[model samples]
Target: MKPTEEDNKIINNRRDFIKTTAIAAAAFMIVPRHVLGRGFVAPSDRLSIAGIGVGGKGKSDIAMFAKSGRADISFLCDVDTRRAAESVKAFPKAKYYKDWREMLDKEHKNFDAVSVSTPDHNHAVQCLGAMQLGKHVFVQKPMAHDIYEARIMTQAAEKYKVVTQMGNQGASNDGTRILKEWYEAGLIGDVHTVHAWTDRPVWPQGISWSINKANVPNELDWDLWLGTAPYKEYVNKLVPFNWRGWWDYGTGALGDMGCHLLEAPFSVLNLKYAKDVQCSVGSVYVDEFQRGYFPESCPPSSHVTLTFPKTEKTNGDIAVHWMDGGIQPVRPAELGDKEIFGDGGSGTLFTGTKGKMMCDTYGLNPRLIPLSKNENLNVTQKYKRVIDGADGHYKQWVDACIAGYGKQELSSPFEIAGPLTEALLIANLAIRGYDLKIDELGEDVYPGRSAKLLWDNDSMRITNFDEVNQFVKREYREGWKSITL
Candidate 1:
């Protein structure tokens, strides 16, 4: 059955076209398949995973996920295609998608897990959507943009029967465990007030809100980028990095740095809830004519005082004071006077009725006050666990994941972590609203201040302030509903 020369040429051309077309289709659809692996590794199954947002902190998250040789990452989603493309160098065989909604719809059920490293506003929606489809989730710190969203996430994670982890990587640190143990042992003796601080002098610290509204870029889908936040025009300062200080995109200095700074104290003291929170702000950082660094919508520098009610519920009542942006606390002059009192880097100072202990946030190293040769004041106990010198926190997560889905303990479970986050977030809320006051108890405690921000947990809406309250949970732009447990 030898073919004629003309027939042979025609067949060859047709075959080449089919081959090229198949390759192109795989390039598009293979994101999930490539990222999730055709079949998960047996018994000790390899997790099929995808990454959303691969720039800035997202890039570091990608690297962390990569460390887990047990997982296969085939799909990389990023609004900035350039950033997404750069990520492919690590997993060349993986696929890429610019829009997560498209990927989720077209490639649903492909992945066993998802890494959500998007902005604060986008975290809940994306994480909820992923978990809705029976997928495991690993989200970045400060789990949600607001208290209500954090509560929703907590409930959803429980309902889904899926594994969830927050990005408070420090929670897994052996030092944190040791601190918790120390508290149980009553080493610090009923820590009454905790002073947490940070020297986060990152770029545009005070100048974050000075963005000049401009036309959206061709590369950025500014509409989609806005996500749940109200439709607003693109501004130069709003994008990339400085969004951390803005009320719409972020929770200001406290939300920006509080999760990390307050971890040690929250962990050691088990600060559950605050009975009352009173905040006062110093002079706004402004020009001669009182031109604030940010718009009138934002807070310049604030000092907040949170008082936890006394109860027979384990430990005694405690007070936590948060100081940021060069606004130090008005406390025991002994601390204000000493240079050590105002060390002010990212850390926590535990002022007990007896002595004080200060620990640098992530470094896990603490020292008792009076730098003089006082050997008796040293914290004799040390963390004997391996987390002290482990390969970055991500490895701990992977090791836990490998031990089988639900068997491992999370570094920060929603039960304890959620409330601590609320305490810090409340500080951000108070900073933005003037004359804000929450009384000893009652839903309408902060009267004459801002309108009551009550949550319709069912709808994820704040009853007051129609304009901004809608931000609680954003309407996903088509094919992007949240993943409910």
Candidate 2:
């Protein structure tokens, strides 16, 4: 139809408007990746992490996440500026804060997840706070200060539906998988006894807390550093490291290496909370005449025996022995006179019905006893290995966070780590119980040393010894929040 110039112009404008509107509607129908599910981030998107304790192990942890090339270290927090200097210098673009509470409060929206590498006592509080905010967490080993805290952290992860990973990097190692495959294939049949030992406490133990308070360093926030622990004056050699020996701040030698050493048994045998535990600790002497009793510090050494109920992988109960502070199990008879047992300093040995196998720390260098049995021996790999093995731990967490909760499997998720941690803490209950004192006839008597502590996993307490239950759930200092699910 031949139309006037104005009519033709109006028709052309209407056609252009309809085409634009249809394009807009199509774009709207294409949902954003985030709307797909909780924590569902697009592949191209980078994860923004707020590190709560960015020093030492914390520093290396966040750096590993950055190495994944999928994460952005957006915020850094530490109680000590001197300790944090290297991290700040490495991640200059990241905003820095001294108090983790302030950082989480003000910048929660800016980050997608939180990495907690603080001291043992503070792990639970910081982790729970982040989970309450719907933030994923990657906490350092042991996960919590107490058994109660570990249980709460485990439940909180489920309740909040947030992804969680404990920093037991060895759980990702191929050695663990190899051991598992060997056991499942009946190469090592029905492991009934496990011995895990370490030469730890390279730091001080069985010592008295310094009475001479040192002036707080200018670069450190002493009060903040004592978070969740009882108020104590700043003492020399406590910061940066040594807190591990003191009961108030650290979990002692067992806490330091149990996760690394005992992880193999837990993974291979599916060992959970211990039903009972007993221990004998080495004592320090102030002089030849008198034995030193420093209840405030972990003993110089100890031998702990924990009994776990049978699992599908086991024929009956299992007895797991833990030794630290340079103690080790008796050398296997099959081992040659000169052959090193457990990498010289630390190792784990599994004594099964058919044969025995051993590995060094972090489940590395696994081999059968008699050592000759390792020759020409091959077991089909039943489990897929994590790329790059143990070193890939950090990237694994980053990938899981991007994939959302319940979408991917983690080597040391809280479900697994919580029980492993509780077992270690349970062993600690016996160690601490060994030092428990009661006054009788005007003289102190140690009854805990004589009893084998019975544990009730549901109640999270020692049924036989009430005093040790005090350690199961400690009292947080006034004004600091306690962990709750």
Candidate 3:
């Protein structure tokens, strides 16, 4: 039955109700970490914070903290002084530094928390440094560039007993929570398959390292930017935004958008692990020799099929298929209605034994098939939407800190998000033309295998090659280093 107009008015009013400043302040101070997954209160009366990498996304992060009207912005660190200088206006009282390590050493015990917004490779080192000093952490997503780093950060957060949050804000959206409630209510029964895809056709889709060397920009510190990544001459094409398609710095399109697209499944299904992973690669976006162009040694696009084995505790297996570059799955013929697939970057389709559910990647909104259903058969659900206030993500973080309450709860917790990130990064690793097998429960992948070995059905481990070991970790630049567990 349709909701009555009067009923709709109340619902709409509640959704639009603005949280008063006083109430908002009280909520944080009173809330606890494990209970308040989206809010936190620091132990101190006043919280000090330092921001590393204040450009692009960092610009937005710094501004959010400024507007929180809570935290004391103590320091700003960025390799690019010009970019760092632009953000100085946001926190006029804060000091600026070029080296993150030097900032941490000089500003020791000065900050109660740190916000790490550097590229994937540097997240662990910067975050761990702050946490080692008993400081809280808010690190950007793709948690780490590789599996080992992911594990190290997760363990470190536990060891330090500090509040830690990953930057996957979509996890807290009302729609995402609704999807979880629907699944728990059995709206989708025993999900067996899922399809997630992203349409991130950003510039520099994929370029292998074949390019005519070009002059490096004087304004940019290419060496500092490359950090621990392999040494290479400057090619303006891969700098700025196109690095996502490269192997050395970014994790291609999947890693770029996977955390957003994969959040729903990873949260709802407890998709704690996967096995029997196989990846199919598409043609390179451009010829390999086109150096310094868009894709500096990455595939333009590819599709990976990750099949999970049924454990003794479960009766059925689950398969997840990932698509990119305008690729999509053919709608299952059994469903009666056509589903709404958002025109945005990424989306998820959950298929269960009885019905299906659909959601856009960012958890913006969701729809259920068979729009009409019997109440007796369907379960009841309630949703409370977070009001529009933390328009800036860092505002959410800083506000929690000032309240002197449990502040580790993240918009995205690293514990839940770490595996989801690893799954996507592993998928990207598979596309590098390797047959990879991972032990989900063991939290490790087979170390020995050939590059082109085909997927094995029974063991999931490739019989001939050592794919997992190749990504164990990476070598760091002399000064720029990742934190080890």
Q: For candidate 3, write residues 76-147 as lDDT tens digits.
A: 888876667678877788888877878889887678888888887667778888878878788777888876
Cα lDDT of model 2 by residue, 73-183, tens digit: 999999999999999999999999999999999999999999999899999999999999999999998899899999999999999998999998999999998999889
What is the TM-score (0 to 1) of candidate 1?
A: 0.76
lDDT by residue for model 1 over 1-485, one digit each (tens)?
89999999999999999999999997765455446667544434566778888777777786777765577776888887655556777777767887777878778777777788777878888888887777777877777887677877887777876677777776666656556555555555667888776655353444533357677767777766777766666777466776676656676677667777787777676666665555665445455677443433445566777776554423667778887766654444444355554345556777776566666665266555543423654445544454533234565556555665567766665666677677776565555444333466555343424343333434544345334443444454554455344
What is the Cα root-mean-square deviation between model 2 and the actual structure? 4.2
Q: Which stretches of candidate 2 lie over 4 Å from their true place?
A: 1-44
Badly placed stretches (over 4 Å) of model 3 are 1-44, 210-212, 285-296, 309-315, 332-339, 370-396, 399-408, 434-464, 478-482
Task: Kindly provide the TM-score of model 2 when superposed on the true structure, using C-alpha atoms.
Answer: 0.93
Give the candidate order by descending TM-score: 2, 3, 1
Better of 1 and 2 by TM-score: 2
When summed lDDT is taken over every stretch of 10 residues in candidate 1, the lowest stretch is 448-457
Q: Against the unseen true structure, what C-alpha lDDT does each candidate score?
A: 0.65, 0.91, 0.69
Ranking by lDDT: 2, 3, 1
